[model samples]
Target: MTANPVYEFTEREQHILKLLVDHYIEQGTPVGSRTLSRLPGIDISAASVRNVMGDLEHMGLLKSPHTSSGRVPTSAAFRVFVDKLLDVKPPEKGTIEHIRTLLDPSLNDQALVKIASNYLSNFTRMAGMVTVPRREEKPLQQVEFLPLSDQRVLVILIISDDDVQNRIIHVQRNYSKDELAEFARELNEVYLGRPLAEVRDRMRKDLERTREDMGNSMQRMIDVAGQVFGPDEAEDNEDSMLMAGESNLLGHADLGDVSKLRDLFNAFQQKRDIFHLLERCVSADGVQIFIGRESGYDALGECSVVTAPYEINGKLLGVLGVVGPKRMSYAQVIPVVDVTSKLLSAALNMRN
Candidate 1:
C-alpha cells in the first residue's frame, strides 16, 4: 500500500476510515477490508481495500486484533472523527424538561443525586456519578447536646437551611443534661447563624483563651469541637464531586483492554484526579470537548469528557459533564450535557 502522498487522504482513504470506525462501533468488533470494499461509494477491489487498510494502520488510526484479520479504530481516530466528522445536535426540549422534572424540588438532595446518577447512566449508556453538595457548606443555625454517658456527649450541629451534622465528644468529666443545655446555650449565644468556618474559628480562639481557666469537662468539649471544625488539614475541602456512569463503559469493545479498565477504576477512586480532569472541561468559556489524552488522565485517555460550567446568578460554581468511551457520539452527548448543566444552574439559582 502506497502512502496517499497528500497529507490528507485521497478521498478514498477518508471514506474507508469512516466506514471502518462506524462498523466497528456498531458491531463492537474489528472490521475487515473485504467488508470495506462491499460498502457503496468506494469502487475498490478487496486487494485495494486491504491496501488502504494498511495505509490507515500506518497512520496510527487503526489497530489490528491479534486474533483477527481486521482493524479497530484507535483513540486517535476517534479524536479525528469527533473533531471533523461527528454530527451532533442539541437535545430535544422534551428531554430537557424530563431532566428538569427529575431534578424537581419535590426530591431531597439524596434522592435527586440518586435519580440524576441513574438518569446520566441510562441516557448516556455509561456509568454515572453525582456528588451532592457537602452539608458543611451550609451555615450553622443551632446546636444541642445530648449526654450519652458520663464522659460522652452527642453534639448536634444544625444549619439554617435544613442541614444537620452530628459529632460525638468525650469529656474527662461528666456533665448533667442541664449542664449540657447550659453549655449549648452559651455556645449558641456565641456562634449560632454564623458560617461553619467562622463559628469554628471563633470557638477555637475562645477555647484557646479559656484553656487554662476551664475545668476538664468544659475543656474536653471545646477540644472535641476544635478537632471537628478545625482548619481543614486534608489539603483542601473537595467542594466539587463526581457522579459517574461506570457501567456504561463496560460493553464497548475498545475497553476490552484490561489495563485500561484497571487504570480507569484507579482514576475513579481518586476524586481529586477526576476533579482536575473536569476542571479542564471548563476553560475560557463555552462547551469544552476533551478527547482521549487531552483529558489529562492517562486512564481516561481512551475516553472523552464534554462539560460546561453551571452557575448561580451568573457566578460559576461548578461544572457538569459526561465521561464516555472515546467512541462516544459527541454530537449526542455534548448537547445533552451542555443543556442539562444550564438547567441545573437555573434550578439552583431559583432556590436562593
Candidate 2:
C-alpha cells in the first residue's frame, strides 16, 4: 500500500472515501461496491464503484483484508477524511447542560478533570484520560527547615493551597538550630509566592555575590537548596495522569486481541507511556486525533486517541482524551473533546 503515491481524488472517489469511512466507523466492517452503488447521492453502478475502489486501493487509501471481504478505509484514508472531508457535529444541548451541571464552579481543578474524564468515557464508551498541569516548580507559600542526625536536614516546601513537598538534604558540617531557623526565614522572605524554578535560579546567582565574611553560611544554604530544588525533582513525584473507564477498551472489537488489550491496559496502570502520548497533544491547540500507529506504540497501533489541550485563563493546564479503536468516529469525538475543554476552562476560571 505504501509503494504508490496517492493520486488526486475525483468527485466520485471522494464520495466513495467519505461513505466508506463513515460506514466503517459505524459498523467496524468493510464496505462492498454494492453498498456504495445504492448509497444516496451516489448515482453509480456496482461496476463503476468497484473500479473506483480499485483505484483508491492502488493509491494506498483503501485495502482489502481478504478476497471475499469488502474494501475498508486505511489509516491514510482517515487522515485525509479528517483533514479534508469530515464535518464536526456540535454537541447536543442535553450534553452541554449535563457538562455544565457537572462542572460546578466550586469544585477544585482536579475534581473537574475527573468529571471530564468520566463524561468522555460515558459519551464515547472509550477509556478516558486527563493529565494534571505540570510545573517545574510550584509557587511557594512558605518553607521550613528541621535538623536531623548524621548531617542531614529535612526541608518542607508549602506550595499551592494545602500542597506540601518534602526533601532531605545532606550537609558537610554540623549546624545549630538557630542557623537553620534563620535560613528558613531568609528563604521565605526572599522567594515567597514565586515558582521554585525562579527561586532556585535567583538564589544560585545571589549565593555567588554574598559578602566574603558570610560566604560559608550562604554557600551551605545554596547547597541545601540545590538538593531540595533540583531541576528534575518534579519528575520524581507520583504520576499526574488521571484515567477512568480503561475497562471499556475490552468492549471494542478492534482491541479483540487479548494480548494487545492487556498491554494497553497495563500501559494505563503504569501511566508513563500514556502520558508520553498525551504530552505531545499539550502544545497542540484544539482537538487532536492519533490514528493507529500514529501513537508510536505497538500496543496502541490498533487504537485511536482523540485528545485536546485544556487551559485556564489562556494558560495550558494539561491534556484530556478518549482512547478507542482506530475505527472511532472523529466527527463525533472531536466536538466532545472541544466542548469539554471549554467547559473545563470555564469551570476553572470560575473557581479562580
Estimate candidate 2's alpha-carbon lDDT, on a 0 to 1 scale: 0.81
- Candidate 1 lDDT over 60-161, as tens digits, reads 889987999889888777766766666678898899889998777555544554576577778988766544444434457788888887678888877635
Model 1 off-target regions past 4 Å?
1-72, 80-87, 160-162, 172-224, 231-248, 257-301, 305-322
Q: Highest TM-score: which candidate?
A: 2
- Computed on alpha carbons, the lDDT of every model, listed in order, comes to 0.70, 0.81
Task: Give the Cα error of residue 156 in candidate 2, in Å.
Answer: 2.2
Worst 10 residues of 2 by lDDT: 230-239
Query: What TM-score would every model get versus the actual structure?
Result: 0.67, 0.89
Candidate 2: tens digits of C-alpha lDDT, residues 133-246: 555435678988899989999888887553577888887766778888888887888889787678877866765664664667677777676666654354521358888898
Native-to-model Cα distance after best TM-score fit, residue 175 in candidate 2, in Å: 3.8
